[model samples]
Target: MAYVISDDCIACGTCIDECPVGAISEGDKYSINPDMCTECGTCADVCPSEAIHQG
Candidate 1:
């Protein structure tokens, strides 16, 4: 499964750059495109708010 971004995201833009597949996008709370996500967990590891998780 792909990783998902939760509401806990602080919109810090940290995950966007961390994603090797560029699956993350900026928004009110940042979003992860499942179709693009490689489930590498890179974003999750860098998210300070711990918003990204396995789906």
Candidate 2:
């Protein structure tokens, strides 16, 4: 499954740098492109708000 960005996202842009596949997008709350996501879990690891999780 792909990792999802939840409502808890702080829009800190931390996960963007950690996404190897560039699946994350900028917004009030960041989004993850499931199609491009590699489920690497790097984004989740770095999320300050603990927003990223497996979908």
Model 2 CA deviation exceeding 4 Å by range: none
For this target, which candidate reaches the highest lDDT against the unseen true structure? 2
Estimate the overall C-alpha local distance difference test score of candidate 2. 0.93
Which pairs of residues collide in candidate 2? none
Q: What is the Å distance of residue 45 in model 2 from its true position?
A: 0.3
User: Which 10 consecutive positions of candidate 1 have the poorest summed lDDT?
Assistant: 12-21
In TM-score terms, which candidate is top? 2
The C-alpha stretches of model 1 lying farther than 4 A from their native spots are none
Q: In order, how many clashes per candidate?
A: 0, 0
Residue lDDT tens for model 2, 1-55: 9999889999999999988889999999999999999998999998988988999
lDDT for model 1: 0.90
The worst-scoring run of ten residues by lDDT in candidate 2 lies at 14-23
Q: Give the TM-score of candidate 2.
A: 0.97
